[model samples]
Target: MPVSAAALAESLGRVPPSCGPVRLVAVDGHAGSGKSTFADWLARGEVPVVHLDDVATHDELFGWTRRLRATLLEPLARGADAEVPVYDWVARRFGPAVRVPCAPLVLIEGVGAGRAALRPYLARVLWMDVDQETAGAAGRLRDGPELDAFWARWTRAEREHFAADPTRPFAHATVSRRTGGYAITPGPRAVLDPDFSDTA
Candidate 1:
């Protein structure tokens, strides 16, 4: 692992586990706020990552909390391995179950990963600090014009989900991906009125 990644993994390892014997960390942000990429970098130490994309389907984008608990949390809570069902976006259904060992640390990366239901199980929550408009634009570009309709539907769902259950306010830290490493600061909850602006 790179120096920064190694340091990050070591830092996370120091935190007390919140879920069973595992430190369940969350990397959450807007759709295109780069949570996946950031989580990938943090996973250079072979940490297991459960991407929400594989857990959410078109009909249940933000309502998979129960499923998540059943598939992952419950098993992990018992100090056992889990088989997380991966949703197939192309087929609009669950494709296969991915085995996840009960590792010492695990990361949940996606929009709404730090929602209320999962907060209690998380050792730390890192919000990807990026504005909605900018992130949405990046999302649109990445998915391409063909998925414009999907993006439109998604933005609405995301907006509603955040309005009802905001995550940033409860985050332990806010991470911004910089040119080479990353800029991590105290989150909204850690610092009053934290200036998490991308320009900052």
Candidate 2:
């Protein structure tokens, strides 16, 4: 029983708003965990998605929590639109700010979206259940050897970051990549039944 993207979106729509008439959902996982693809599919419902990668820079990857809270969350929580900084990964710097319209449903997708500091504002947290080794390998392959050094450093930082403030314990659900789609299941803290679904 693979759950379709529409079904997942429907399920998300059922969640009560956690902040200012907005159901802020966070999709977190290791690098190269297929979060971007899944987020795009989820956003097909027209939900505005805020990519954490856009908020983080070479100097501050997992350290963009403060920036996110101040720039995006605070304003969104007040039902006000805010301008968010978009980082250019190629240039390793932040470019112009992009307007983040106040939406009823917002998806924040990234590696540390479920960090302890950001969880209180989230209505639901989805974890992509992919092993670090596999994710790292995929990332290396995708980014090529040019980023090997950066990946090495990122791996260490990610390990430390997760160790200090793990998100798995608080995740509402877990998503695993299947041949043609994904398998969704309730996390350890979830009380809901497993839901599988497909997405292109």
Candidate 3:
């Protein structure tokens, strides 16, 4: 069956408060996985989202956990709005900070949104069921050849990150895109993690 945003929202209502009154949901997968697209679909105006891209910088592609913690998570956890700087990839500089208000639901979508450190504060984790190679290619195609060098470094960093802190094994759900919409199923790891038994 299709995973409706309404249904997911209702489910999110049940997960324990990770960020004050907000339910922090993570949409994670390989870089080329359709995470951003899927997150846009799932959000659909029901919730606010903080894309990790805004937190990541050219100098710290995978070293953005600290930035996220300070700018996003910390404030949200205190039931306050967060002012996070947006990184301009082209300029290689962080732009003006953006305010993200505290809401009932929040989505964090990116490759490492479900990292070990962030998982504890997440109400639920969703992994895109796409291979790294395939996703990387799609990402490259979307971004174009101009980013070829960046993609190379990105792939290596992503591989290392996932290898050390695999998010798929801990995700509560797995999402796949179909022609019409997306199909969401219980993650394989959900069965083993007692915390996810309700969804499993």
Best by lDDT: 1
TM-score of 3: 0.91
Per-candidate TM-score against the hidden true structure: 0.93, 0.93, 0.91
In angstroms, give how far residue 18 of model 2 lies from its true place.
1.5
Q: How accurate locally is residue 100 in candidate 2, as Cα lDDT from 0 to 100?
A: 78
Model 3: colliding residue pairs: 32-135
After superposition, which runs of candidate 2 have C-alpha atoms over 4 Å from their true positions? 191-200
Q: Assess each prediction's global lDDT (C-alpha) against the native.
A: 0.87, 0.85, 0.83
**Residue-level lDDT tens digits of model 3 in 107-154:** 999989999999878888889999998999999999999999999999
Better of 1 and 3 by lDDT: 1
Off by over 4 Å in 3: 191-200
Write down the RMSD of candidate 2 (Cα, Å): 2.7
Q: 17-77 in candidate 1: lDDT tens per residue?
A: 8889999999999999999999999898499999999999899989999999999998998
Model 3: residue 23 alpha-carbon error in angstroms: 0.7
C-alpha root-mean-square deviation, each candidate: 3.6, 2.7, 3.2
Evaluated at residue 144, the lDDT of candidate 3 is 99
Instruction: Write one digit per residue (lDDT tens) for candidate 2, span 1-200.
Output: 45677778778877888767788889999999888888988788588889988998889978898899989999998999879999999988789998878887889999999998998899889998898999899999999999999999999999999999998899888888777677787776763233443222
